[model samples]
Target: MSVPSQVDLASCADEPIHIPGSIQPHGFLLFLDAAGRIEGWSANAPEILAGQLQLGLAYTTLPLPPACTDLIAECIDLLAEGEYAPAVAAVSIAGHDYDAIVHGSHGRVIAEFESRDVPADTVAMFAVKAHSSIERVRRQRSIEGLLETAVRQVREFTGFDRVMAYVFREDDSGDVVAEARRDDLAPYLGQRYPAGDIPAQARRLYVLNTLRMIADIGYTPVPLLGAPGAAPLDMSFGVLRSVSPIHVEYLQNMGVHASMSVSIVINGRLWGLIACHHMAPKRVPHAIRMAADVLAQVMASTVQSIEARSDAELVEQSAKVRTALVESLLIDEEPLDALARHADDLLAATRSQALVSVHNGKIISHGPIERETAEAIVRAMPADASDILVRDKLGEWPQDVHASVGKWVGLLGLPFDPPGGGWCLLLRTEQIEHVSWGGRPEKLAQVGPLGERLTPRGSFDAWHETVRGHAHPWEATVLANARLTQSELLRASNARRAQLDSTRAQLLAMLGHDLRDPLHSINMAGTLLERGAVQPTLGRRIQSSSNRMQRLIGQVLDMSRIDGGMGLGMVFEPLDLAALVEDVIDESRMAYPSIDYSFANPGPTCVRADGGRLGQVLSNLLSNARHHGEVGRPIVATLAREPGWAVLEVANGGAPIAQDVAASLFNPFKRSSLHNPRNRTGMGLGLYIVAQIVREHQGEIAYRHEHGQVVFTVRLPLAEMERAGPT
Candidate 1:
């Protein structure tokens, strides 16, 4: 046959140019001019020209019959106009029909040919067949629908007992989604077959061969070539003949005696299969099989279209759901409730049963399921886990109430930690039908707990039979894409955490280094002054500086500890509250002699507390009052014992903290205002430390503005102190 220009004939010029073997046995070539007139013919042209023309006649120059002549002319015109590529068609020569092809190159028809010696009826039939195929393709609603139709048509036309469009599952399993069968045959429309049934080696062969047939499972194989240097003989059933006998046996076990499969390739990979099976041994002519193969090609395109559309829809839906969830989390403040309300809809959209769990390492709040049951699930999952579809059964749940519940068939966990110290668990349950493998017959008889009466054999008998014809349901590409998205989100979250940690470390280092230098200088000056080693005025100034430095250093350390998540140890004791307040007052007066201080203590008051930390709390409050309040105003220090705790109040006539500032006052390094730049000397950790210390003592600390005065109070639990007895 004459090759198309696009076929790169030059590449094969040096080699013996033999025709590519095809199921269609007859081959012919005809050369045509740009104007559609035949120019020349190959030496084999007579095979096609025999019955239609006389010997030595120039068929190329002769006017063709109207039936095929117009069709050829139209093809030539389209090719010259660059509308058609090298394409196949059918034409009439004399009273006979011949399948023909025209090859175009350099804006001209280079070659054309038609089969010879065909009957007139076959020629007319061929033309009608070619037109029908083209029309069917052009009228398809969608690629998937088109492919489905194509497979059905092939099965009907080829008289295959059972034909199916089998697609690969994400886990490599195969499923039959579309099927056509004889009236007496049962359908396998949705049936799923295990990956092992196909085997890696078998799958590779299917993809490589593109089309294969086991004409007769019991047929004695005919070996095309013998072993190297071996004598030629009837080598049927030899290992080298064709398909392995082992595979044939496997097919027979599945009740299929004869089978033909064509690989559906998408994006250069084996996407699935178009499979035809027969229960009885059958023989199909080569031409008929070639026609079926062409139909399969059309089906492949349809499959691609369907897959693309489905993917687009999935992506759009996922985007919407993910956006809603994330927005509610960052913007709504109450994300948990929002998620709970929308949980059902979200689960349905994803075709999953979702569970959300909130955990703080020790405490957990499970969604939907019982807390104990949820906790058990969490414990079963590993931290360095990946998403999976669990098919094996989980025998029993940890909680007794759920003892009779069927084992968990499938689970997917996605962990997320919110802004605070809690984790959000996104879990999905696998569909029962999928997990049970549609209830295979061989494994159904196995007994388990909940009594033998409830064995899989009995429980799933109806379901097993019902789902036998159902295809496996899974979209591997979709899940893979989702996993990639989740991984990216996790990576970003980890990166942000690392950045925050680095910033915190740098800030702590800066604070410690900056504060230590001043503290050392002040301490040295204080020692000299206390020893009378400086002038009286200098000594007084040195003492004040030393006290200020000590306060700064304490604030730095306290802030550091809190930020570092260090827990506090409380040495609780029943102490005389009155005496403690009096001592705090005496110390404050001694340090700020110019500042007036008043102490009011309920007589013989007693409570429990860590004395040193409490003293530090009192000192920080008093110092704050002296530094920020009216400098010379009297600072009131009051102590009293209520039913369950001791209360200490430190008040001064200072500018009251703003509402916003008061809310965050206990936060480290959070100051009231930046109005007084000169007084910004403190690191803003005093009150924060005070709150920490009081909390360690099992106390509460708070501040409120009252009558132009700011009052800070510390209330400690009395029973805690009493239990400790002494520090």
Candidate 2:
């Protein structure tokens, strides 16, 4: 048979399995309204109650045994008191023993009576059986051992021919991981089943009602007959709820006459099922079913404990790696550089084939991946993506992305918070999987007596499939490690930002203090000149002090622009580079008259540049030389012309820059306190501003300590007019 289209499989999930409106023939149902009136009764109720039941009649007046009536009354009282938990009791109805289960549903009460085929177990017997089973389950330390034990105990308790513990994968498909069965039966262990076998609505009901039993797959559905305009009864908690027609056909096709499933819910999620099957019609008494429910609960709890312990171990191990990475980030080195250094640790932590980091539009990889592949993979990520993405099957991804992903079939990407923060990606190569499915794992839409509808595949034989373009599934431990690493990276980035803010605060405070001295000199000189002491020395003092104040203010403004991500604005023009250098040298000579200054120019070297910014650069470099150089050494400025370029060098005699300070030489607020502490009165924005302005002019700047002197070089392209001789 041809498999159904994806649409047909999805439509199956939309069936309203919760409100089936009917139940298996083994039970009778009645729904009572808030006033105790019977608003709904199953079609089989008339024959079971000897034609004495009627809709809208009070349940208290029904012809039921005192045991059944008393249980219903108590269930009603509990509902009146806001308790909705279901209550069950053994009762004799029409001389036949039955299990009366009552529960509140949708502001009404549901009463169901299931005929008992075998004698009910005493409470003591049930307790002993449950305790022994639960103890056996709890004693198993591993999940596989625990599930194996659970299946054996359930089969022993229910006398089922086959029992299997099935576990759901991340995709909702399931695998029978453990099984206990009669020697005559074929084992379902290790057989995979597709997600369509259960459907979404069925999975939901499984969570709502943790235990379900189908006494006979071929039994007729007993539909509920209700008052006019009455809504379909909600059988979400119904133990005898009539399952989907497709599910019934599915079991028949597998040669199963009866079935029972107890949900394995871990942390409130339907993790899997303890499925039981028999070759003959088998109706398990309510007590045995309840005992199985209890055992399943214990099994779920034990599984949770085992898995939690495993995850906890991984978290502890990853925490150590994350702590080490964070500590490296706190050091003086760049954060990205630190991440590169710890790339091996990250790979080990995630157990990934490779790792890559993308920040500030730069990519750093630590594996066999080429730069182009890494760039393409990063580009394929959503621009607004902010959460961790884990993809194991590259074949399932969009076709457009496949080309970019290349041979890698798995990608785990963790995006940092606050846009443009950064991203980390872990990559894995493809690993083909040979899966053994329980059947062909497909349903077919067939035209039958009821028209076109999906039917379960009529095959139970083992089928083999070769799955390609998939990587090894990322373990829960790996995912947890990725989350932990992402959290630490965010925390470290925030801390770094905080430290930068503190540094900015200190720089501003120092700028204010440095301004006061220059401002006071200007004010005092102006007062002296106004008092008829108009000496050339006082006039020069005012001019020098005013210039100092201007330079100080310019540095502050330039720093603000750089910090705000705004580059320095420039007006490009052709100018004599030598003249600009000479003018700055003369100004600096006067500013520090006590220090020797020298200048050399190879004629007029013209370049297109921002003249004022370039002058600021020269003044800052000269001032830096005077403040740090030997007291008697000359601050030399040399300008030369190269092919299509103008080169300028500023050489100052000084001890080489400290390794620590040189690490961030052009970074803002990087003043050296090791020498001339008084000269460090200004904010350390001079060198940073110079670097920024040089970059804006399309020029190159470099610093070198060689030949017993520190040399700062700037290279700018010669202007077209300068190169072509005024053409």
Candidate 3:
């Protein structure tokens, strides 16, 4: 047979081994629909059954003995109930006993018949051997010991020339960690196989099927016969499914004629495999293979148990480190400084050479790494990665970055959210490793009897390589500990920020209270000097400065009160909103005599609001217009009545607020720094206080820069017209 070239790795991986539409010569397969009518049959079916087998023929009417048909019928019944699993039975066909394996696949019942080359063992006898093998495997505490016992027991049970336990690594390459073989056979223990040796699709099938066998690698493949235009039968679950030609060639090159593999699966992931090889053509009876499956399962559970215990120890140590670091963060006033104190412990816990924490936009680190290197490492982190990330090699970096990590080859990262958004990183130095492969681990093109095509490498000798620029992989327990630490740091950081905000507000309130008495004394002194007509000009200037100071102090007190959760107290009543607007405009005209002013008064618009708070809102909005408006432009104010509401609009002509500053225009402590700096005054609380007063009245306020003009609008619910009264 001409095998496809392996030059194209993608094509080699795409090879469809599942629907080969054939079976090995030692067994024949028959595909039947739910009604028990034969829809397809292997080309060798007639020869094996000793009678003609036709498509569309009822299986029960076949010339097989009654036992085989009854067994198949029961399997078909199970398929109807959605409980179908592979079942095997011994039955006589044409006076010769055969092993019948039945299962359901692709909406059809698949039956396979393998000629009996050896007598089948009784259930009691197989159970005794299986129990003995499983017990031996379970008694071992370490994974190495368990695998060693498993290979020995499987080799004894199957009588294979060689048996090896192969464990897969994270990269899918595998090592033959344990082996049992005859004295004359060459040892394959500790030999590694490349991931490409078994394509990706083949690994997936191993997980699904779990157990597979090839009685003879040299046997001819018998094709299946089906109706015209019928889709190729899906033999994914077929017991007698044909093996891939390339795989058959691989085994022959290795001098393995017969082979069996049982999967070691744990927690739904393919962990490893138990592979058995024979130098001569050998057929393992169905019962022996089942026993090997049981032994494999026991080995898998024992491995899981050992791993869990190992992880538990690591977790205990990790908990101690995490607890210390978290306590430092919560107890110490400076969290980054606290982390620095425990840098060595943090590094040792994750097996790293360096530790760095990015907090409050500052890099605090205790390691040999430079500040530039730390920044680069943080920038290299994948934005889409979750809270924690692990990297062991430079090859995994994104394309735009350099494929080098200097002296270090691995890193672990934890990203912190804003207040100061940054990352914590741990770096690991490179470790050199020496690896031994079963062969060169490369597929080469060679001319065989059929043609010049890609075939398995001929050499089975060990090949060695020195691997460099990689670090020991990060463990699961380390990541778990990092996640726990990340969660605690976030919580404690939030608590600290809240406490700081509360303290600042309390300080502001205290300063506002303490300065009021001194300011009142200054105002009283200025008033006396003006009444005495002594230095009247100086007295007026002093009074003017004191009035400005008084307003600034009042705004500060109002902001502190709101921030401290004491909301502005208000008494709602009906008043003429137009009158309030006119009074505020009159005051603004006096405050800035040079600026032109205009008012559009919708007379006597009644509104439900606290008259004092509403007057403050009008005053603040007018003051904002006066301060920020263009020197020659007129400040305009208007009041209007809409359905169920009263609308107040204040407009000024000037440069619109920058997009960056406009978003926080009404937020406390914002400044007009980007505007006319000379006009900056009163802690920038004018618009903020106005917005708060409007909200307290259950009104909506909005600001927009449109058509080269900045406008502020307030909408409040209207009161009954009958309640309108003069203020």
Candidate 4:
């Protein structure tokens, strides 16, 4: 005989098995229409019947006696009620006995007959075995446990040498998660089979036909010959249907003489299969196959129940993580800082190796990564990307990202342009998997006349491949949980901003009241002075009120300028600090002659500063001392020059600053910082303005308690002062 064409065998996967027109000759098949007429019959149909089964003839006219007809009619009625109609009826036709099976679907009926006395109690016996197996399957607490028990029970029930729980992964590739086999036979447990092993059409058939059995791999095919004008039969539900030639070759390559598989349907989808294989030719009876189908049904429900519980736990954990991140943000003033606080925790939660967070052009990372890699990732990402970009295999990604990610196998990107720029990317490293395929993966594709062809490998030996740049796939729940985190953080950021806005509004209202009180004092003093009824006290009060108004206006303008990011336009010059202090004190003496002032400077300390701003700082400090100083005690001002620094000290004998109040003493809009009741009415902006000026001049200011007195000191670099020389 000529050699079979390798090309034809390679392309056999695309074969239309549904209309293959032939079936295994183990049983005879008859097709009936909606009216119960014999519309078609297999080539072997005449073997079991008393005579030829005439096409277009009513099935009732057949010589299948009353009891067999009634059993078939009852099965048909049950099928109409959406229940699986039981077959296995006894028929006595023309002095010959036959075991018949009936199935009704889609307004068509198919009945098959075998020349055997199928045990009269086979259905009852199978039911008892099925119930026992289902009870065992139900007792399993996890999907793995359920699959393990299912394979064991199927192996025992079918008497196959090996039975495996073939589960499909997210990529549609399958793996033997659990298995049961004879000790002598080598195990196929945990071996991954490529997705091409089972074609898409075959998966569809598994959904329609839950039970499939092959008595022997080499059985002759029985063809179904339709009459003229008849459509080819749809054998999707055929039990003894002829197997796909490619699949047959595949089994033969694996040293299997017979095989059977039952579909595990979960949530109306084909989840996996309970595959049974025998090394020697074996014939599994219909009764055993029926028992296996029931076991699969129970297994499907058990798997779904276990998954539901696992999903519930995952959701609970995700909620807890989100709550913690939100609570962290609630107390934090900066949104980015809050997100950074949970960076490590969030990275661990996603089960990734690393995470990167970008906020307003600043980047924070939780794992070991190079700056170039981070910039590469940011470059590849879309600016307005709102959806999570998840990749399972980094090697499969576009070259731009693939090269950048390096050994990282997976990534979950949450990119968003928040004003300027903000995004987050989580990464996972490759898990080098040494997968064991059933056959030599290299031989599966051979160099034929054409470049490459899909061919069954000759050796069913263990094959190894070092899978690189690919991680275990991310679950849907993981992506969803991360998405939820991004959304929660965004909401938290908005809430924090709103809180700040409310605080600003309250500050504005307070400023309105504070400004009005000072304005009213000036207005009353000016009116009294205009009427020539102003005493010395009234005249001094008017001057003090006017000075207070000018100070408040300057504080507001300085705040606006600082917020606008405008640096102080300093006219730096050599200034005599001792002389400046004397002038400020003389002015203060005129304003508050009741309070004594003393001044001292070791030398003429000349320094560089914005003279106007520096003088404003000194004036504010002296004013504060005057208001909060001990009554009848002299306020002392001293300037001293030290190595590379100029020090200014203003000390007053009064209550020291409270620790809590001192902490925010220079923060804008902080509450009153004075000990006197009258001084508490001023806007809390003078110290803030002074602090800003000091920072702009690159100087340091601090408060200290010395000998029951509150001492404020200023320290500025004296490098330039030394260059200018002592005055």
Say which candidate scores most in lDDT.
2
Query: Worst 10-residue stretch by lDDT in candidate 4?
Result: 1-10
Provide the lowest-lDDT 10-residue window in model 3: 1-10
TM for every model, in the order presented, reads 0.45, 0.64, 0.63, 0.68
Give the clash total for candidate 1: 9
User: Could you give candidate 4's per-residue lDDT for residues 147-234 as a string of tens digits?
Assistant: 8888887776567899999998766778889999999988889788877777789888888788887777777777776565466666
lDDT of 3: 0.76
lDDT of 2: 0.79
Off by over 4 Å in 4: 1-14, 46-52, 65-67, 74-99, 114-130, 343-349, 367-380, 396-404, 415-417, 440-455, 498-727
Candidate 1 ranges with C-alpha deviation above 4 Å: 1-148, 170-173, 196-200, 214-259, 267-270, 278-287, 312-352, 355-367, 381-424, 434-727
Residue 94's C-alpha lDDT in candidate 4? 58
Q: Name the best candidate (by TM-score).
A: 4
Query: What are the candidates' C-alpha RMSDs?
Result: 14.0, 12.5, 21.4, 10.4
Candidate 1: worst-modelled 10 consecutive residues by lDDT: 15-24
Question: Of the candidates numbered 1 and 3, which has the greater lDDT value?
Answer: 3
lDDT of each: 0.55, 0.79, 0.76, 0.74
Task: Summing lDDT over every window of 10 consecutive residues in candidate 2, give the lowest-scoring window.
Answer: 1-10
lDDT by residue for model 3 (1-727), tens: 1221211112323467887767888877787888889777787765644355666778876776666677678878777777467888787765666788888866688888877767545544655776798898889999989998899988877789999999998889999999999899889998899988888778888887888989899888887877765667777766677888888888988999999999999987779999999999998877778888888888888889999998887778778877886666654434665577788887877878987776544566678977776766656765555477777876665554544346566878876444555466788877787888999988878886435766777888999989887888887778887788777767777776676586467546645654565577677776777798565566666666677677777777777665444557789887888998888788888877898889977788888788888888887777778777877888888888787788889999988888767766765555443224655344556776777788767687888988778899999988866334335
RMSD of 2: 12.5
Model 1: colliding residue pairs? 48-116, 97-123, 143-302, 190-469, 190-470, 190-471, 191-470, 221-236, 608-721
